[model samples]
Target: MQMPLLIAADWLLVVCAEQLAYWLRRDGLPIAVPTFHIPDVYLYLIVPAIFLVFLHESRMKFRAFPLWKMTQAVFHAVLWSVLAIIMLMYFGHVAQVVSRLFVAMTGVFAFLFLIAGRTALAALLDRYHLFEVPVLLVGGGDEADALLSTLAAHGGCGMHCIGLVTDARVPQKAAARCAVLGHLADLERVIGETGIQNVLVTASGADSDEQVRLVRRIQPLVENVVLVPDLAGLPVANSEIEGILEGRHIFLRFRNNLARRKNLVFKRLFDIVLCLLGAPLVLPVCLAIALAIKHDDGGPVFFAHRRVGQGGKEFPCYKFRTMVTDGDRILADYLAAHPEARKDWENDFKLKDDPRVTKIGAFLRKTSLDELPQVWNVLKGDMSLVGPRPIIRAEIPKYGEHFADFCLVPPGITGMWQVNGRSDTTYEGRVRMDSWYVRNWSVWIDLACLVRTFAVVLRREGAY
Candidate 1:
């Protein structure tokens, strides 16, 4: 594993050194011409050696070559290489000797070179399974079978399942070629015999106490131990390590903290600027929508509903009324009459060809113009320009405990899940997307989502 990375690093160093020398000559720096004198020959030798040391010290085995981890390593390598080059130049009493442009160019060249070469290296690592880790599955239930199938499908995780260990009766029937090593109680003995380096506890059949015991017992024997949470129908946004305590216990927390005060400030400023600038243009459309609504049905043009917002606060969310006066009552009556509509309602909270929607309301809902009134929500600080969609107060309990994480950030007019597939996506998928957005929030991501929202709204792919 280190051989390819070392060779790649050496080649990258040589190329960068040569380029730096050439660029220095071009810049009229009084550096020796390219002949037999390589300005940084020592770099070619020492850089790769130091890289190997760091790689070994960090334990960056090829088995854990996820793109994210690889990127982090590359970044670390580039940073160290830059610092090393600077130190070498300073020690050689050549601080003012080398062109700054040459040093900067070398850093950029090394970064790109390593990134490209790492891709090839990763391919080679995957081909040989050189760093595959032996993983032991500790359950024999349906979740274990599903996890096995998933692992089989994703061959790149580099986890080679040795076998399964479970006392559950049903697991034996579904256990594919994976042999049942022993009962759950005999996990320690199995680990001792097989030398399993990783243990994955399926959260389904195993009780919490059993899972905790398995972790405690196996921690001494194995290098990695992970517990799969039994969160069926719950969204697993994205996992992240919070910290390590006392060099023993690891803590993991999940929440989207990207929509912080800085982001909130920027988003609000953007909204206020855009809203003020376009108010004249938007006013006419608002009036046109009001006229259309009034013409279709002589009822109020604006609709207000209690929606759960940041920190689980209920606020009156505004939207263009896209239904008749007694739309909710009518919906209940309709669902009672036609049981099939209940399925659609349950899935998407929407009804196709909803009878309660007035003639203009149907058009507004299709184009999503009914949500225009939420601009006021953005103005009032009750919502953001980009965030998770707000849900009704009545829908809060259904989200369970993870709902608090989702509500940490204010709801948005348009968000990742909304632009991706609003009503068309599964409820669980929406929650997951929302959770992911919260976990991985960034201004650029918010801007991208906003741009995509415009395109999606124009296309109206899943508006209704």
Candidate 2:
């Protein structure tokens, strides 16, 4: 039922995209752009059918994918669908007659409309567990509890743990969260009784041989069998599993995407292009911020805090001055006077309501306009547009072993920490997020972070 509804919703959005593209080409928008050739609307109605086929081929209905996976699948489907349409048009000798602008606009609108629609649909389905796949956990303890917590946090993943089937004594924490239906011996009976569609086998104190046998026995009972390996907190984003010796042995390959020379060049080019394109809009806001800061304090417009950059190099990170000249003294004095505030500062190095912040600075920090001057750092090659957050020398000990990973990429104006929670995130959690970003660095991830940054700033979330 869920699959059919999702497919219908997707088909409808594709049709709507075609109409919107036609409307854009036919009618002029407020922004000026070249438009030519009146597109034949009826001739393009077959686009939705073609797109739906490509989407189905992408396996969107196979499993409940996380939001990121769903986005990637939809993007690929739309891209391939557009290419197929172009090829078909060229072969049919209709490419010259149809408006090229209309064709391009349709692809753009299709992706936007599909993403918006799918996100709304996923949220709606999650509210009622309409599309969730019920699965039985074959292990119970810390492993099962951790998996349960992750599934609960990401409801869009479409997995729901129905019960546990471990032979060992269930830990109090796991027992409290999930029902232990039966032991490993009753795995078959449990599946029959509960009508479970999938089985998740976790490595919870089970020997390799026992685990393998359990998987083999359960494979015949469940429609899907998912193996949960102990590979958490590792960079598996750009990894692949290869089977050697006629599938007798298998090993996972992890690629260091950031280390590639071509990727580094591309990342730099990406930063420069974005900075150049955004200068016109950013310049005006920067001017306004500079004026407001001057009016509020009659001090310097910019502040450069010393921070550790790529390769553990120190540089002055530029920002609109959000604090007074005597901010260091004010912070020290305030922390000494207030133990609670001191504890908070020692924990995250941030204060929700610091007395040192000027009136204009508070708004600037909330809106993230204070960091506009960091564009200079970006252009100066001191920073990338998206990477790990710049850390101070005092915080180096917090990162510990992960500090090396953090130094691989230049610090960012905004990165996983800024987009995820910023000041609200724990110091340790920020370090973890930064380490993850460096390990899993990709052009797509950077672009996604940049897009999420705008939404985070606009909503004024997790900022001082």
Candidate 3:
């Protein structure tokens, strides 16, 4: 049940599965099974190496294994197996000798074996609580209560609360559930006695100076000293400390396409090519929109808004004008008069039946012809054919720190969010889709989004 033993057992299972796969591929079965020429030793190295790389990339340590993490490891193992088989066929110089069907069967067997082993390990770990870590909560009042609640929710994942340590006198209700050993001064003594390996302090109960002192004192005793920020709802960008004192300032950065540079470049190239090819088709639709807008209200045919683009740069994004002239002014007055519409506008940034939209504009928006002008932006390199949707300055505040990180790449005319659900999705859902795109971007992914966008546009799904 110890961490080292658990890790050793997992490693052994992986090794055994690899060996079995090798044996199956090398030898013919007793019951008249087909045999193929296979490089058994090569896969032995390939499978483990791929698993190790995935493990490192995921940042999962042996002590804190979770079922979800284990499932991901198995999934990556399968992916790597497929990749290795492809490489062998293409470049291993022995494709003529090996049966392609046999190679495929080996991959499937290996994948199933990996998944089964991990799943079994996960069940065993959960049943026994083999990797659970003893944690000592240190705080008081509502902050302490909130910490307790969070620990209770995620208690299965190696975080066991021993008790609480508070600066102020513990409330009777909290004391009933968790023993309050002592105040801040008793932290070190309590941790030592309880054999606690982790100390978690809430920012609300512990001030900056006290937090610093607690960290320094607990550093030598416990495995880690964790500070839970006061702001529970806000997303925290992953942060790191660099260099020694004087240079040791914290750097906060969002998790993005750090491992996807090559894919991003390929995607950008694909975007350029698609935009160029679609220009002729998109131009005529844009012209028609321009003519329609001109005929309807005799106003500017295009709406140019200063939008946050790549790296938070302000760029004029073009769209066919979908609203009446002075629509911005009209919006404020209309929202004031119709409180229900204002509430909906606050939630979705859209109004279903607004007087501001011209008749032609309604038709254009329904079919998404209004977005044709953004193809020019894509051609001009201000945007991509696929990426996060650009937002105006007014919308920046709503996105908070994530806004800046989202702007690292150019905005897109059609994106993962747009194809997935568009205006029907919640703000949080949109953020998740955008983040997913940033992390998993590829040329193929872009193409897939474009293909799906065609279907979405045709169905007019999620269009207001």
Candidate 4:
């Protein structure tokens, strides 16, 4: 509950960054001498107020930031720094003594230091469990178990589930992580004893009326109360908080994939720009690869296979020919000879020592040069630059319920699975990975995966 210290730290860190920036910029990066003097008053006074206001605008409450997330805090820091620069531009002109270079330098340092400070503080809090908010879990059965698991995994999210208030039918001994402090009737007593600030309602067995009653009773007792809806089993994308019946009953709507054209338009523009930029570098290499493939097997240079794309429509996902001619026949013969290879192929749809792969193909696959041609697929609107791996019709059932979610977006040549572990990942494991990626889709995540793909390829950790 001693969270005001974090707020104070936030302010002080920005001021420190500004001072550091002043010295660095005045003396260059080497810190020699002040060529341009920064207005001391702005660095010490006006800028701190500006930062607090921007942070307030970002809806930063005096709460533990474990739930707020470091990425969001860093993002807020950037936003405040930009706004601070704009404010200085206006106010500095009136003050008659502010250096533009100094202001720019201050902004840059403020951004970095704010992030670094918050990260260090968050880590300290996590280490000491300072941000841990004692909470009571309401309900029982599978939902309760899932919530318990989630809370345990995300302890740094400020949720320390101190006690449980489950139904009598659900054995209290079953929940080994936290003690069953009391039953539903003794909820207030449990809260008082546990010093609970948050209450999580996961009423799996309870009906709507019981849920409403529980929520009404627990509303004033805790600072925050969360309801876990029945939709947890399904992969939902965007969710929203809403109130019904004149604000008495509130619940979260776990939204299904709402494919917005604007987002797709953004993705398309990103794909096109990246492709055009890399075309020159990749084209020559692609030509050489084609020639080698042709020379190796006297077969087609490119291999285009019909793979499932967005909306369950099939598209020709292109790649350089990596397998020998009559690949299927060769694979059957190979599998017949080696039981271990057959088992490996059955498990992950990949073979570490595939007899069908040409030497050139093996090298290309290892380095992920095989996917260079799929940039064409990205440009032609068939696949994304980063998404779920392109699945053929035979692989649809492998996704199960995940199939619908997977098809909601275009398949990718490189994705969460490809980056995390390509051929080494099991088919079921990939389904889970791709499902999570789709459910938590963001432009930042896509960019991160694309960047990590290079590292993964270079390391050749999972690639065959």
* Model 4: CA > 4 A from native: 1-37, 40-49, 56-77, 94-130, 168-174, 233-237, 249-258, 274-306, 311-330, 337-344, 351-373, 400-405, 413-429, 432-464
Displacement of residue 265 (Cα, Å) in model 1 is 7.5
Instruction: Give a tens-digit lDDT track for model 3, residues 1-464.
Output: 55455445545555565556445555644432344444555545554555445434655553344333354555665567567656756686643455554555555665556545555564566466666667787878877776675544444455666788888666676676688888878887898889888878765756678777767787899888887768543323223334556754544454444346775677677777877887788778777778878988899988888888988889999988888888889999998999999998886677878778889988888888898988878878899988888887777777765675577688889887898778888887787667666654555456557766887899999876
Give the lDDT ranking, best first. Answer: 2, 4, 1, 3
Which candidate number has the best lDDT? 2
lDDT of 1 by residue, 434-456 (tens): 77677666555565576567767
lDDT of each prediction vs. the true structure?
Answer: 0.71, 0.83, 0.69, 0.75
Estimate candidate 1's alpha-carbon lDDT, on a 0 to 1 scale: 0.71
Per-candidate RMSD, Å: 9.9, 2.7, 10.5, 5.9
Per candidate, the number of residue pairs that clash is: 2, 0, 0, 0
How much does candidate 3 score in TM-score? Answer: 0.46
Better of 1 and 4 by TM-score: 4
Query: So what's the TM-score on candidate 1?
Result: 0.51
Worst 10 residues of 1 by lDDT: 32-41
